[model samples]
Target chain A: MGVGPSTKETSLHHFRDPLVDIVGSDSGIDLMGVLVFGSPEGNEEKIRCSRTAAVVAECCRPDGVIVETDGWGNLDVDYVNCVNEIGERGIPVAGLNWSGTAGTFVVDSPYLDNVVDFNKNPEGIESNIVGENNYTADDVRECVKRLKIAMLKKGMNK
Target chain B: MGVQEIDLRRLVIKSFHMTDVQMGDENKITMDGKLTIDGSYVKDLAERHSKVIEKIDIQIIQPGDHDRYTNTIMDIIPISTKVLGKCGEGITHTVTGVYVMPTGVDVDGEQAHEFGSSEGNLKDMLYLNRAGTPSDTDIIISFDITFKKGMGQERHAIIEAYHAVDEWIQVYREQMKKFNGNKATEKHEYHDVIRPGQKKVLIIKEMIAHGAMLDTWIFPNEPSGVAGGKSLIDYGCMPVMLTPNEFRDGAIHSMN
Candidate 1:
């Protein structure tokens, strides 16, 4: 059977922690709220954020839990309060800083910068972020190969 | 690699539909059908269908443009034995014409022409007629076509095509309704305006054609760099080219 949308989103969300680790703690990672833009059908913005969120979650496993609102107006204020409530227990509640519609929320560690820039330079991190550059076909092939190896390792570990 | 010669016989047309729903005081639904066929059809169908068939011509017109140039046509001569076995030996017959197009084209004319005294083999053209039951000595001919925009943009082109086909079909149906008398007018009107009997079959065929193009062309494949600059890569391999701010500004402009 085809995967439902929610399951797909969850699976995608699970993939981001590794990259988050590369960024290091001093950079201050902020989990953004849901990124919603464009016609719902086009989904260009949603896909970008979802992919970024998933990758960050994979890279930062155990360090942070990125929260994405289900949609605009669907955010649970009580849930935000609950995360804040947990912060009172001394747990770190990082809010992913996504832009567009659902950009506002409260969090323990808030990364004020927009999440969009990270999607562009997902690999590089530091005081200096590289400008946009087109990838050669070779670059893409290598990335795919790396992703495949990472996926295989993940499956074997599981 | 040079242009690859795909086995035409292996190709088939697949058909499907896209539905859009609108909510209001009363819900409204519209369904657009699609057709997909392999690129090989460009050569194979053109060859096979051309045999025993006379010719077909296609023209593209932009919106507000009155003139049209012939796009392409196929002519074919069929092997008689195939027709005898497939369509039966003793049937009134003539060459049947079939044309398929994406939803972008507005087909205006559908007619048949017979070569003088040439005993055209019917088998080759049998597929052209949906019924395949034509009386012997009768030139069984029809034209099926679609008019739609090229897969990308050309909104005006699609509108023009739709208007042209609509006008033509309307005229044909009216003539049929007149011939069948007033009693058949209502039924004929419904069939003609709402769903044209003859055009419906062609529309289905066009949907298959459109689907094939979408699958092969629109759907991204391994993102191989065109030209000699790069090798094969997966589709959507690149990051989103636009920044969020740029995108947001563009969205604001569109709304305005």
Candidate 2:
């Protein structure tokens, strides 16, 4: 889904796999996901995605949420909207980020509620490389786990 | 094409639920349903398609295994045997919980996927909902097929590379043909039935019918089969109506 590799682009990428990996690796959590595409204004796809996620999030009433995007050019639109839309729901989100580093580190994304680095341990999160892929499956699992904890702490503090 | 009555006979598919997959001295499916792959079988298959495959590395990824993933995936095929007749009209015995797949790059690191190459850690890159990478319930017979450096992007080279590994499944296809259906855990049947009073429905599926990596295979003598199947793209993207049972019984498969 890119518009013929031209000036226009859509967020129909395969980040769902890694997102699935993050949630799927942890045995405790059930990963229900939907890939959202959009236009600048009112697109049916965007409305459906927003509404569907809100409904699921309300129904599941999960501990917390972790959101990330490809963060290159127009891709940031979906990421920002997902975080803010979910955050606007009064649910805490610890956004996972990838930056220029070997290990995980917290970076500034659009949503600042809670941000966790994919490659760095950050401050409170304890993570390490467990595979030839540099970071292990445990890395993804730990990041999500730490995000949930961080969100829980924020919820209590608020 | 005129209005013709397509008679599709018994398209019964059997599934032997695979329990565990291992690479050891023997290359056979045990009575206990464990898949033991002999290293020599891969060598022989590679030799047969020696023109395409420079090196063949066989690896089996089981559920709950950490730090295990595949290289770039080319195709996911189910092991099946044509018991009665040819594809689209036969009793085909197959396994459910296991998949035969090809992964990896050429001798030099190049993208094998024609459109997009998701080559990274297998655990991270593999999406569970897709074929071959089912949740903890299934096992993957991943063949790391590496081609020569320059042969990576060539269409013919890519097809040959895929056919090289498809030969492995062909062996299972032949062997499974002799399988006793009574031992099957499940059986599915397809037929071209007529409903005289009811309105008929014909569903047309436009699939990957090109020389690229994005391709869909239909009625290849097996479910998601490749070896002897015809490419839809080669058929000039023609229209073919299939019975619902044929679709349910594994007449269509994908490689995207």
Candidate 3:
């Protein structure tokens, strides 16, 4: 759930605050906390390259983990690597999809076991995009909420 | 220490749009979106008052350059200026399409950053579709600097490194002051109207005050700006308050 310097959440905007803070609070479980990877503006891959995985593994050590990328493209590499590293710690992993292109959303990420796609839902809607008629912050909140539930179910093994 | 209301006008940032960039005989941005820079002119500026710098090299990187990378990034600066009074005051002009990033390493390839080092290909490192993500249509200027040996972690050495890069950015800060407000693509107005019944909120953002690589600056001349900014570490990482307008107007600058 950590953001990089590339996104306004990590740099300029405070959009991620309520969205991430909702994770442990909204569930009424007090079960999760989003870690800000805080990789520099460029060189986000360093999170995977560094021993940060060990740090994250030691920190969360959760029953499951949910990884969401606020922005699209190259950051997917960082998100997927982060999930892979967390999964290697013997944890089940789920992902929140931000990609809407033709191919390879969560499927592209090798380590993500389950994915929640708000856009794919017939009832689905936009979440965190900007411009004309972009998704509302409510849509993102719902999406993350769904991801937490999906990760919980995945951890339960049906 | 207590509540203070600084005029919101200080944070009014005026901006200019740059469509493209290139290297040429002089440092200038054209009306048709051409940014020309004589690299030597910038190198000369960096060499001054910084005994730690061995050499400075400038490179032009476009949206999709292949196999290109920069190590030890220090700052990502939006070229802008204060049209009147001090920084964070009056009219601040900014160039929207161009950004400057400074990079450096010690003589033995030691990075200038302390804790985490960002060293990788430029393309993969960047995140697109975000607020700060420069468009693929934007121009990037990489000021790659190499420093004297054993100075990578010295507080004064890092400050001098920032000084050298900031000197290079000063070139654009001066040029942007000439832009008229009519030519601006957009204007945003901010006001602090006291609503008697609304929920008053205060958010205390604890920024990094660690010296050397991990440091955050306050009230830079521009947003995420480096030049003429104060280090939080020097201030003992004390709690500082900023109004919403001040926060939006580039008052907090993070560097490594």
Q: Candidate 2, clashing residue pairs?
A: A103-A119, A103-A120, A104-A119, A104-A120, A105-A120, B69-B122, B209-B233
Cα lDDT of model 1 by residue, B133-164, tens digit: 12222221122233321311232322222223
Better of 2 and 3 by lDDT: 3
| Residue B186 lDDT (model 2) | 85
When just chain B is superposed on the true chain B, each candidate scores a TM-score of: 0.20, 0.84, 0.87
Poorly placed runs, candidate 2 (over 4 Å): A1-158, B1-9, B129-133, B195-199, B253-255
C-alpha local distance difference test of each model: 0.20, 0.51, 0.53
For candidate 1, what is the DockQ-based docking class?
incorrect
Say which prediction, candidate 2 or candidate 3, comes out ahead on DockQ: 3
lDDT digits (tens) for residues A1-158 of candidate 3: 12122221332223113333333233233232233332222343334432364345446445555555443344455556666665566555555544444213432445665544423313232222111112234545665555456556665786
Model 3 residue B42 distance off true place after TM-score fit, in angstroms: 2.2
lDDT of 3 by residue, B49-168 (tens): 458877778888876772576775565666665666553345666676777767778778887765545456666555433444446777778888787887877878777777776666
Report each candidate's C-alpha RMSD, comma-separated, in the order given.
25.8, 14.0, 12.1
* Ranking of candidates on lDDT, top first: 3, 2, 1
Please give the distance, in angstroms, between residue A60's alpha carbon in candidate 2 and its true position after superposition.
Answer: 46
Angstrom error of the Cα, residue B188, model 3: value is: 2.5
Give the candidate number with the greatest DockQ: 3
Q: TM-score for each prediction?
A: 0.17, 0.57, 0.60
Q: lDDT, candidate 3, residue B186?
A: 58
